[model samples]
Target chain A: MKPIEARTERGRRAPPLPSPGVRFGEGFLDRLGRLALRVRSRRERREGGGEARLLGGGMEFVGFRPYRPGEDLRRLDWNLFARHRRPFVRVSRRESSERWSVLLDRSASMGTGFPGKLQLAAEVVLGLKAAANIEGAEVDLHLMVRGEPHRHRGRGAALAEWMELLESTEARGRGGLARLLAEPGRFKDARALFLVGDLADLQPADIPRLTRSGRDILLVQVLAPEERDPTRLPEATHGDAVRWADPESTGVRTVRLDAHALAEYERGLGARLEAWRAIAAHHRVSFTTVTSDTPFEAVVERVFAR
Target chain B: MSVPQVAAALALGIEWSRPSGLLLLGPAALLLLLARRSARPVERVTATFDLWEDAMRRIPPAPRTRRLPPLPVVFAAVAITCAALALAGPRIVGSDPPRVFTILCDRSPSTSLPLQPGRTRFEVALEACLSELARRAGSTDRVRWRSQDRETLELPVGVKPPASWFARPAAFLPEIEWEREDRPGFLWVTDRVPTPSPSHALVFASGGRGVPGPVASRGGERVVWREGGLRVEPAPGRVVELRGVEAGRLGPLARLLTIWARERGFELRGGQERERALLIEAGRGAGETRELRIAGGSLGWGLAGTGGAGGIAELPEGAQVWRFGEASGGEAPILVAGSPGRVLLAFDGVRSVEGDPALFALAWSRFLDRWVLPAPGVVPLDERRDAGAASWDEWSEDRFEEVPRVGAGRGETTSADLLAPALAGIGVLFATLAILLSGGGISWLRGRLPASRTRT
Candidate 1:
């Protein structure tokens, strides 16, 4: 499937990506395969399923619990009920038949950074799709472009088709995470939903609403190293003044790089990060920050290993 | 003095000409203040207004102080002062009073004696007079030349003696003016000591050479034969004889004999026909020609013949001759004669005379006065000595101070334009300083402005 063109705040199309193909070299694939194996092992040991907790018929027993009145008799363990003279249900581990839905933010803000947040997020998405395919789960790629969601579904090798489309996508437009995820019908069947973006424009209040749609919501905030600590940016600390331009909105601000102003900026940024952490905790959504400079394998290992 | 009194005195001392330039200072100061408000540095920023506004609200505003801007105020003050000074026409008050000077210059024959080889005492005295006059006498000073107690000539102030005046005959006064009062200081230039005077005066004596003093003699009807000519003493009706040589051969000597005989009232006979009271023989060896050589005669009182070719005489044994004609080997006298009665000529004829006639006449006139003139009861005044001896002790410093100040008229006043270049220079300096100070002050003020964030 072809990726939709991202739009800017002015409703103008952004520049196209440099190339239409993303090459995964043998070494990169080997690293990614090892990371995927680790993720599967860890998930199996912890939950007996791959990144999900869905009920299904399986031979491995999970646990027993008191049977409810309306529960099916087939689930009842008669042998345990005769010994205990109480009705107990037999619970088997669910099969690892899960659907993975990846929501990628194709916003102008993601266009900043060394490897670019969009590029890093695409790599992360590709790694996740590969891991999901390996685990025999169906994967869907949903790209949020210009505040609209476009989805593409595939299984196995077909899941790899979206790599080219993801590579062709340029970072443009503003992504509305909460609004896109609030429509739960499209992603109701998906066991795990991954939202990948810089997340700079997202408000803390939007987190809980976004978490309601997906059974498990993984928020991978793909930020540039400069965005996390602006002082590390080469141009930020040099001159008496620095100008910051927002990629997602028509907003610009210039400030003196004096001690007081730099301290204030750091404080504001810290508060924003803390607020996001609090929101994530409150919503029970898995949250992790990944800098664009991090290696793809490292990100995969860090985000998917549990 | 009190400050206001001093200021008033200064204000009264200066007169102003242009009072309009002071208006510029007001506008300049206002413009400078406005410029300070606008020159603050501006910086561009983005949509962080909410955060920035909050941060700014947290920061307390700086305290306000009531004080003037030092540099600007100083610059303005300097500029205003300079402008005010320039606008006002300034002048100093007062006048220089004029004075009158009177100069009394001595004009005497002895002043002609040479001080140096070429410069006469008269010339030196004249030079000194001119120098003194140029020094102390202004153009309006009065000057008069006095000789023999009379004003020979009056000179305009600052007038130099004519170049020919040095070569001209000496000015002689016939009589003295005794009634004039000496008010202004008198300057006497002479070669002799003058008698004392009661007025304020300064004497400049050129005392290089001494003049001959008056001679005293006791005689009755004496006929003296001195060098150059003969003289008769007390000759009321003297008879003189010229026994040798014809009148035609006598030449200049005949003319001298006629003038002398007329002055002495002598009856002259050409030959020795009557009883001769005196005799003058012109031809060589015609009469007894005594060659008496004088020993150290006074050359100052004698005539020195100039040029070659004139009658020569023999000197007495061991006599020292001052000057003589070439005919006698320049050692003998120019004439040989007796002291009181007889006279003789060494030349064959006076036609051979070729010397200074006036000088020769002066020598003979002096001889006549010594031998023929009667002794008077009183000696004639030596004008140079009288002028030189005139006492200037009365001309003390106090008397000099009393001389009316000449040259400048009374109540004279002058305008001193004190504002042209001096006040203009001060104004320009103040203006330049003001400009520089304003620029620097405005820069500092702009730096002090609050930091701003704006769009690029």
Candidate 2:
């Protein structure tokens, strides 16, 4: 694989790399390895690319087949022809690998969680990048923020560079998952698309745009535990009254915390999740909910296993 | 109202003292308005609000709160109410230190009438008078008990009267020239109305089957006739001749007789008196006979109609009996007369009279004035002539109403300072509760409460 090339823009520069000897935690790497093995096994089973197989002989002379009209002359086995006095062709099996596109949402809402949804999403992206590296597959990293994509490519040290970029990244503005998916130029030959976002502000119709590309689409919904069950949130449970402000719009509302209000909130959340699920199903997308508190490796294993 | 005036009004039992304090309500309302205009600090949150916003839209907006929270406003209201009340000086008036009371009790013969089975008119009058004194007397108030006939006697606080006090007969005549400045209040308890005076007087009329006839007066004196007796004005003086009677036999009655004579300007002669003088003679013996001429008729004592001592006796024809003795079947007459100028008095218990000398003196005094002496210059006033027939309104006015002159004395006004502490306490309690409710105490308490099941 080619080393990832740095792309620079007029007013934006790539994030600086971390110093040498800096590495992800060993425990995180071990979990990532386990998750990578599972993904590779699954991929191999589905695509039949786990081992080498012989076809028509090549320079290694693994096997031969009788020559047919209009066959390539370069692939003809001359030794077999001279010995057997018959035309033959050589063949060889080629190793196949998948390309994965990891899309991370860096919206303002993602920055709201305790461990931060953006941090969790970055961890998940790192896990996927590590898996692809082990599998000798091509990987692309995209940070979707404010309807613009910041892209990086490669593995190993490139993975470290991506990690450093994500570490220095601050979540702000709006995510453009739907916009990025609609732009074919952004992910033109990618085999699989892994999106990590809260998807909180996205419309239900926005998710189906990913299906237009006919690529393997995985929708990983990264959410804070408080977002998943707001009634358990301190603000909602500890006081008789609370004021909720929107991070994106800066709009505000005050509400009384009561059993009825909590019930309504839970119902609304359930409905939202259900609507997302339905949208995902209609678009043939794999959808999963991951909380910021969930281990990144566990998220990767669950989301990429099947 | 002026502060002192408001305080005074409060002291006098007026409601809503310091009405001007209501102006504070306007400021309180303004404070509330400013609070409402002030915005609550916003809470910065990051979760997607689309669903919550939608849900909120589905429901109605919560009722707008005061710029201040409910708890704080409630507390403020409580504090204001308390402060207003305190400034207003809300109080219950009239619980002042006791006042001095001088009570004059009537112990006339008519007061002995049994108005109820067990209670005499005098007993009823005494109770009513003492209750009045008690009502006016504070812990430190001094009370003096005076009989119409006797000198005033200071009574210890809360002391109960002996039953004999009510039974004792009139010991002295009412003092018409007494001054009012000697005591804060002067109460007269009697069966007949006395002359109204410039001095503040509380007259409690007791006894008799019906209300006494309106009082009638001539000159400075007044009189009323009721209770089966002639209640005269200015009891007249009389000269009495004691014939054939030894002073030693009269016991304590001798001294009382002399005092009565001195009070009435009467002389007690040692021998038979001249014409128109009262004659007192003990029966010479069980057999001694005495002739009495009255009202153009003549009767012989110890004769057929006038039996011996302790026997039923009848007055001669045309003779009027003024008063009766206690003996059953009318054995003796307390006072008898032939005409307005002629009268005779006799009694069998001179030895026993010493036991209650004042009572006996009063009885003899009344007998002398009614039977022997000419009526005093002050004539009896008839109720029908002076005040007309009694009406219920007038009766109630006469019995129950008291018109006090403004600023007369502390006796008419009450102090209300006792209510200050209580009103202040109530205000403070409300303020404390408001503080707790408004100052995050509610949330703290909610935290302490069992978690609601619906809260995830």
Deviation of model 2 at B162, angstroms: 75
- Per-residue alpha-carbon lDDT of candidate 2 for residues A246-271, written as tens digits (9 for 90 to 100): 55554655655556566667788888
Task: Point out where model 1 deviates above 4 Å.
Answer: A1-27, A47-97, A145-147, A156-159, A176-179, A212-214, A235-239, B1-456
Per-residue lDDT tens digits for candidate 2, residues B155-178, read 665675565554443222333443
Instruction: Name the lDDT value of residue A185 in candidate 1.
Output: 72
lDDT of 1 by residue, B181-296 (tens): 34455666655545454355555566663333322223234444334334545522445677656666566657777777666656556866343345665553324433322222
Task: List DockQ, one per candidate, in order.
Answer: 0.03, 0.14
DockQ score for candidate 2: 0.14
The worst-scoring run of ten residues by lDDT in candidate 1 chain A lies at A1-10
- How does residue B251 of candidate 1 score in lDDT? 65
User: What docking grade applies to model 1?
Assistant: incorrect
CA lDDT, every model vs. true structure: 0.54, 0.55
